[model samples]
Target: MRTGERRPTLADVAAEAGVSVALVSIVMREAPGASAATRQRVLEVARRLDYQPDSRARLLRSGESRLLGVVFSVRHPFHDDLLTGLYDAADKQGYELTLSAVTPRRDERTAIAGLLQDRCAALILLGPLAPTAELATLADRLPVVVMTRAVRHRAVDVVRTDDSRGLQLAVDHLVELGHRRIAHVDGARWVASADRRQGYRDAMRRHGLEEFVRIIPGGSGEEDGARAARLLLDDPPTAVAVFNDLAATGLLDVLRRHNLDVPGDISVVGYDDSSFSALAHIDLTTVAQDIDTMATLAVSRAVERVAGAQVVHRETVIAPRMVIRGTTGPPR
Candidate 1:
C-alpha cells in the first residue's frame, strides 16, 4: 500500500455501511430508490468519516446539476410551508433545492430563465401567476412543477387545492349556522381567485340563497382583509368567508375596532388553516390544505422526472377539509 493516498469515496462508505455503492450514491444525490434504513446507515457512515461528495465532480460525471430551482413568494406563510416541505422532500431524495424569491415586479419568464442560468435540473414555482401557455412553453424546455396554482398544459405538472370545493365547504358551513347573507373576501389575480369566486356563487345558489351572495374584492393578505372589512362596515353581512387566514386576521382586527363580536354579530370564516389560523388569539375557522401530501407528491413528481422517468402532464388536486374553530357560530 502507498504511504499517502486520497481519502475514501462513496465506495468506501458503502462498504463500511454494509450497503451498495449505488445506495450510497442515492443518499448523496437525494434521489429515490433506497429504503429509509439503508439511507440512514449510509448517511451515518458518511458523517462519521466526514465524507463530502464532490458535487462538481458528481455533476460532471452525471451531466446533471442535481439542483432543483424553487421560486416562492416572499414573506408568505403558505409559500413558507411549501418551501419547508419541498426542502424536506428534496433532501430525503438526495436532491439540492436552490431557492429564489419572485419579486412581484419580475415576470415569470425572467425569473425562470435566471434559474436556468444557474444550471438547475428543474423548477418549482410556488403560486405562479403566469398564463397557461407560458407555463406550457417552459415545460417544453425543462421539467416544471407549479404549486398552489392550476395549469391545463399537458407539458407541465400542477399541485394545488381544489379551490372550488374549498370554497363550497366554507359556504355550506356558514349556511348551516343559519347564515342567510354571507359575503366572501375574494382571492387575488390567479386561477385560484376565479375558481373560488364561482364556488362561492354556486354554493349560495345551491342553498337557495343566491340573493344573499356578496363579493368583496380582497387579496390573500391581512391588509386586504382589513380593507374588505372596512368596505362592509356600513352594511356588514351576517357572516363572511375570507380568502385565507392572513386576510382573516385583518378582518378580525377591523371587526374588533368596530365593536362587533365575531360569531355573535358577524361570524367569519377563513381559508388555508395556516399556522396563524390556529393561534390561541386568532382561532380562526378555516379550510385546511393537506400540506404533507402536497409536499410529498410535489417532490416525488419532480424527482421522478429528474431520475429519467417520464411524467405525464397533469395536475394533482387535493381536497380541502373545513376546520371549525372559535371564529364561527350561529348568526345573531
Candidate 2:
C-alpha cells in the first residue's frame, strides 16, 4: 500500500460485501457457517478491494502456525535437491517450509535464531555441524530434526543416509573392478566425514587391501579435492573414492590437467551424486542418497512431533546406492 493509505481490513471487506464482519471472517477462513453464495460474494468483493489477509496474525491468534523451519548450507548443491523434496513433502503434510541458509559469513546459530523469531513450529537442519550438547539443548526447546548426520542425542530426530554404508559401497564398486590399490579422500572437516572415512577403512581391510590403503585429507569444496589429488601425484593409487561430489569435481579437474585419463589411469568415485555429476562433461560415478525419502521422513517427524504424536524411532537411516558412469571403470 502507498504511504498514508489505510490497508484494507476484514471490516472493509465486510462493508463492501454487505455482510457482517463475523460472516466475512467465516468466508475468508472457509469456516462451515458461510453459504456458497455469501462466500463467493465476499471473495469477489475482497479481490476487488485488493484485500490480503494477515495470515501470520490470524495464525498467532489461533495459537498455532504451520510453518516448518529449514536450516541448510548455501554451498552444497545436494542441499538444493533436498530443498525441492522438502517443499513437496511439507505441502503434503499440510505445512509450509521457511528457509534459513548457512553461508560462509553466516553461522547456523544465526540462521536458527531467525527461524525462532519467526515462530517456526519445528526445525529441520541439513548436515548440521553443531555440537552434540548444543543440538540436545535446541531439541529441549522445540522439535529439531537433524538431517545427513547421526547425533547421539535422544531428543533430536535424525534423518540421514548411512554415511559409512555409502563409503563402503564406493569401495566395493572399485574393488569389483579389480582395483586393489584403492585410496580414500576424506572430508574430515565435514559432518559425516569421520563415518565415511571409517567405512572406507573397513571396506579396504575386508578386501585384504590393508597394505595398499591410503587416506588423503580433504575439505568441503573443489579446491580441497584438487589439493588431495595433487598430494597423490607422487604415488597415485589405482582408484580413489572422494568425500563428496563438489570435492570430486576438483580432483577430476586436476587429474585431467596432469594428462591422467580417468578410469584408464585411475578410476574415481564421489559421494552425493549431485546435480553436476550427470552433466555431459562431468559424468561422475558416485554414491546417491535418497533425497525424497530423507526429506519426507524429516518433514513427517517434525510434523508428528509438533502434533504431539508418539515418536517410535528417533533416528531413521536410509540406504545409498552407487551410480555407475564414465568416471569409473576397470583400472587398466
Candidate 3:
C-alpha cells in the first residue's frame, strides 16, 4: 500500500483471496455459510493486507449497534473511575461504549448530539445537568439511563447512589469520632448537592448538633474546595464533610499549607471513594458508591431496554458505604 493511501477494503481482501465479496463478508462475520477452510484462507489474506473491518458500518447494516452512549464530564475524577467500570461492564454484556465528554467549551446538548449522530442504542449519562422535562423528551426517543443523579420520569431510568444516605454516613462517622462542630463543604445547586446537604443537616439534627451545622458554599471542583477552605480558616469547624474527593483533596491541600493537621486538628471526610481517594498519599475517608455494581446494572438496564424488554422501575438507588481511611479521627 502506498503511503497516505486509503486503507484496504473488503473488496481488496476478496480480490486477493480469489473469493467473491459475499464470501469475504461471510468470513469476516464468521457466519455459518462460509466453510472453515475458506474462512481460514480469507482471514489469512485479510491479515496480510492489514484489513480492518469498520465496526460502525457493520453494526449499522445489521441494525443492532449495541452501542451505549455515555455522556460524562471531563473534569470529575470520579467520572473517570466510572468510565473504567462502565467499559468493563459493557464488554461483559457484549456491548460497546461511545463516550461523549462535557468539557468546558462543549455543552451537554452538543455532547449528546454527537452520540445521537453515532446512532447509539442507549444513553448512559453521568451526572447530567439537563432538566426533567428535557430528559423526558430524550427518553421518548431512546432508552435513557441517568447515573449519579436523581430524576423522576416514566420514560427515564436512573441509577445512582443514595446521595442523602451517603452524606448521612459521612456526618455520622464524623460525629462518632467525637466531632461536635462539623461543617459541610457543599456543592451548591449541583446535581446530588441538595441530597448531600440535606443529609448533612439531618445527620446533624439527629446527633443533636444542629447549632454546629454550618454549610460553606462550595462546588464540585478543587478550586471550590480551596475557596471554602479559605473561608473555614476564620471559624474552622472541628471536622468537615466535603462534597467529593476532588474538593476534599483541595481542602486538604489548603489545610496543609496553613499548617493544619488533618484529623488531629480538623477531621475531614469526603464523599465518593474515587480511585484518587484511595491513593497512598490522600487516603481520604469517603462514602463509597459501588461503581462496579452501578456500572453493571446500568449496562444491563440499557441492554434490556435496547432489546425491547419491559422495564418496570424508573430508578435504581444503590446504597453507599463508608470507607474509613487516614483522614478521620477524634478532633483535638
Candidate 4:
C-alpha cells in the first residue's frame, strides 16, 4: 500500500487472500458456508489490509436496517440506566441501537425525526412526552414502543412500570413509619406525573390521611425540586414523597442547606430509585422500577413488530418494589 492510499475494500482483501469475492462476503458476514481455515485466512488478510465491511451498504442490500432507535432524555439518570439495559437487550436479539437524546436544545420531536431519517426499523421511546395523536401518527409510519409511560394507542405498544403502585408504595412506607403529614412533590408535566400524583392522593385517602394531603408543583428536574422545597419550607410536612430520584436529590440538598435533618425533622421518599439514589451519601428510600425487565420487554416487542409478528398492541406493566434506606424514618 502506498502513502495515503485509498482504504482497502472487500475485493482487495479477496485478491490478497487469493479467494473469490463471494467467499470474502461469506467470511465478512460470518455465514455458515465457509470452512473454518478459509474463514480464518480471509479474516487475517482483511485485518492486514485494514478492510472493514460497510454495514450501511449491507443493510441497504438486505432492505432491513435491524436498527432499534431509542429516544431518551439526557437530564434523567434513570434514562441512562434504561439505555444500558436496552443496549444489552437489543444485542441479545441481533439488533443494533441508534440513540437520539432529548437535550436542553433538542426537543423530542427533533430527536425522533432524526431517528426516522436514519431509517430505524422500529422506535423505543423512553418516557416520551409526545401527545397520543402524534404517537399514533408516528406508529403508522413504523413500529413504535413506548416505555415508562402508560398510554392506550391503537398503533403503539407500551412497556412501563406500575407508576400508581409505585407511588402507593412510597406513601405506604411513610405511613408505616408513622408519618401522617405526608406531602407529594409532583412531576407536573412528566409522563408518569398524573398517575403518581393520583396514586399519592389515593394512598393518603386509603390510610384516612386525606385531610393532610398536599401536592407541591414540581417537574422532573433539580430546579423543579428546589422550587418545591422552598414551598414546602413555608409549611413543611413531616415527610415528603418526591416525583423521582433526581428531584428528590435536589430537595435533599435544599433541606440540608436549610439545616433540616433528613429522617429526623422530615423524612423523604423518592420514586424511580435511580443510580444517584443509591449513593453512599444520598441513600434515598424510594420505589424501584424494574429497569432490566422493562428494557428486555420493550426490545422484544419492538423486534417482534419489526419482524412482522402478529402481536397485539398491549401495555405490559411491571410492579415496582420499595427500597428502604437512609432517607426515610419515623416523623419527628
lDDT of each: 0.86, 0.93, 0.93, 0.92
lDDT of 2 at 83: 96
Task: Please report, as a residue range, the 10-residue window in candidate 3 with the lowest summed lDDT.
Answer: 55-64
How would you encode candidate 1's per-residue C-alpha lDDT over 253-305 as one tens digit per residue? 99999999997999999887887778888999998888878888888888787
TM-score sort, best first? 3, 4, 2, 1
For candidate 2, which ten residues in a row score worst on lDDT? 54-63
Spell out the clash pairs found in candidate 3. none
State TM-scores per candidate. Answer: 0.81, 0.90, 0.95, 0.91
**Highest TM-score model number:** 3
The better-scoring model by TM-score among 1 and 2 is: 2
The deviation in Å at residue 63 for candidate 2 is 1.5
Residue 329 displacement in candidate 2 (angstroms): 0.5
- Please provide, for model 3 over 177-217, each residue's C-alpha lDDT reduced to its tens digit, 9 standing for 90 to 100: 88899999999878899999999999999999988889999
In model 1, the clashing pairs are: 29-94, 30-93, 30-94, 30-95, 31-93
Q: How good is model 1 by TM-score?
A: 0.81
RMSD of 2: 2.9
lDDT of 4: 0.92
Show where candidate 1 strays beyond 4 Å.
Answer: 1-62, 104-107
